[model samples]
Target: MMMHRQYLIDQAIIARNILRVALPLQRLRASATRPTLPETPTRFAIIAGDVTDPSSSLGDLAMFSALMQSLRAQNPDSIFTIIGERRHTIVVPGIGETPVEPAWAGKTGTLAFDELIRQHHALFVMGADILDGKYGAALVQRIVAYCNHSVLLGIPATMLGFSFNRNPRAPAVHALSRLHPHVTVNIRDQPSLDRFTRIVGVLAQLCADSAFLMPSATDPITEPEAWIASMRQEGRTPVGINLNAHALAPAIAEVGMDQLIDHFAEQFKRAGEQNGLAFMLLPHDLKSQSGDVSMLQALDQALQRKGFTHVRYASIDQPDKIKRLIGLLDLAITGRMHLVIASLGSGTPTLSITYQDKFEGLYQHFELSLEHTITPMQCLTDELLRKINDAFMHRHDNRARILSHLPRVKALASQNLAIATCGHTD
Candidate 1:
């Protein structure tokens, strides 16, 4: 049934794309004839919003950096700019910094929103938190209204399959769509594109998650043998676990911190005991003050009560370091979408404790059975345990299946980039 629905969705998108192309040619041609502005070399701006938070994983940053490299290689004249929060001093390699405008101050600085839009040829908006509430839609609309030649690469929360409510600021998005037709909006998943199109009356092109296209290493981490030896010496299995305790204001109504911590801790205990794996609590977003310290403390206490002595916790601040930790994992189970993507992309077997639709899309894209991945909020304990055990038993096969799908996802990303830049396949 899921396959059939996906097929129908794909067909609908293709049909919409055809209509969008055929219908817009005349309008585009008329706009094109007005004046051929002299082609200045293209400059790409990655408007990351916040880049220094502990919650921002290294894998995600690496993938975005890789995208910048690809763009620079394709167009050597292109320069890349990163507009980030004032406190975030951490930088992605190959990206130049531009300070982000404070929300309350309302756009005044050396790099004013209007001036930034006028200077850059393309824009890539990469973070998940940026799209919460109507901010994402409003931001895109603002860019479209002021910058005629720019594209907004949005990673909408709806990509994870959560519904996007029409907030009070939605009218701003609609207004911009009506006022500036040249601004292209691209989303990470199909459902988000569908929702955005339904609301704004402009078809949004679908693109695969950029994380999947990240370059894999033949040997990404150093001294793997030493790490493995240390684990063996300690009589531990070195299992990696990523628990997302942080919730943006928007996510609280859907799931709370206490429930999330309890759910993960319980699952970790069960999986560790059954599989002989020691728990390594991996915190993906350390900057959000989600009470990770308390959560870890709680898990440690739970492990002691259960008579499990092999447990450790690690927090990472750099993307390369995160990649190394992921490489060290014999197996990983995660709630964060990017963690699962990183593990799978790195050839590590993973079980996704799903909280959204993006997880389902990723599993489906890899042709993995949905039965193996659990939605903790919805599943019973018995069901969750059964799935975990099944994942362990079939980890090898599932890892192979996921690796096979990476090329297709990468190809899709490349194809989308071509279409977005040139309006046709390269």
Candidate 2:
């Protein structure tokens, strides 16, 4: 009881401080502009708590970055107020570098009660995973607090490029349903949009996953160093492999980790022997304890245990560089969403071992067959090798199909930005 009361008191103080600083910050922003301008436009952005994250943010930051580019192109007058403990530089696809900082760790200072948030035009809440209001989730508290407060204040709040794991009851249909015309929600897949509109009674606009619209990553262009030139020259088809350690380890804990690693290695070895292909391990994250970089090592050790040592591993933290490497492959075998996004975005053929709805959902969005997907439960069976062989054999045709579908998908993603900024989809 005391803890809950203290929480409310802290919130009250924070809100009061923000309210107190609102007018001065408004005055400061008002002073910066031209006399011909009518009013200063600002946006309140609520990103996931880990704004500095690379892998866990998944490919959502790439989409958010693309959205930032669109906002800069269309709504030049807009400034942003981001909410997080820490902020860092993220390469915004085509727009180069943008700092995603609205607050620093443990310090409110002058920007503490952000004027843009207090007297804001719109609120944007997004992340790869947080937008899914699942139970026992931490970030949804921020969304609930911010959106509810903003809606009550008559500020337009938008949930941008997110998915819902389940219909939220704690912050369910009430606040959003009541906000009516002021709130806007854009989802990346038809499945998510259908669920939101059908079960939750909130209207959700369909947009291609924002990752599809991110500008060609500079990682491949900027890095210049070849992470895998020797292997590329070997005259055999190269396959890019990304295993999602975070999801796979926890979800498949019932299966021993060593056995799981051996299963993948054995399959890869079989695929190599059958198809005359070389494999390259690509790491998508470096900072996290359980990120792709560390996990790649574990898989490598496992492969060594089985006397397989010829497989090459590539360590890269830049999303763009990862995309470039994925493009070099004849086929991508991945459990991670961003790896799949980078592979297919560049029209690199892919076969995914999916653990979440996001993968199957996005693949469905592209009208691609999910026959190539295998679950962890199906990993011990022969289905893994079958999909691997089939996907590689028909990779060129799949690449062409992906390329054919891309322009249309990119345009729809752009329409999502248009609707958010200009209130029109076309």
Q: Which residue pairs show backbone clashes in model 2? A: 219-321
Q: TM-scores, in order shown?
A: 0.70, 0.78
The runs of at least 3 residues in candidate 1 whose Cα sits more than 4 Å from the true structure, single-residue gaps closed, are 1-42, 49-63, 75-78, 85-89, 93-111, 127-181, 216-225, 232-237, 246-263, 291-294, 328-330, 379-382, 419-426
RMSD of candidate 2 to the truth, in angstroms, is: 6.2
Model 2: how far is 1 from its true place, Å? 21
Residue range with the least summed lDDT across 10 consecutive positions in model 1: 153-162
Show model 2 residue runs off by greater than 4 Å. Answer: 1-46, 49-58, 75-81, 87-114, 119-121, 135-138, 151-156, 166-180, 218-229, 287-291, 304-310, 419-426
Q: How many residue pairs clash in each candidate?
A: 4, 1
Give the worst 10-residue stretch by lDDT in candidate 2: 417-426
Candidate of highest TM-score: 2
lDDT of 2 by residue, 134-240 (tens): 42223343454455444434455666666655544433333345334445677877877787677667666887766676656554443323434555576567788
In model 2, what is the error at residue 336, expressed in angstroms?
A: 1.6
Candidate 1, 1-426: lDDT as tens digits: 986885575455434423432233324434432222224536655555343342255545665655665666678776755554343444554554423432111233222433454455555555343342343333433333323323221111111111233341343444435523334444555555565567656545565666655554434444443555577687667767665453222233356655545555576678778887776666665554644445666667777766776676665554445555675666777766767766776766777776534565566667778776766554334565676677788878877887788788666555334413322110
Q: For candidate 1, report its TM-score.
A: 0.70
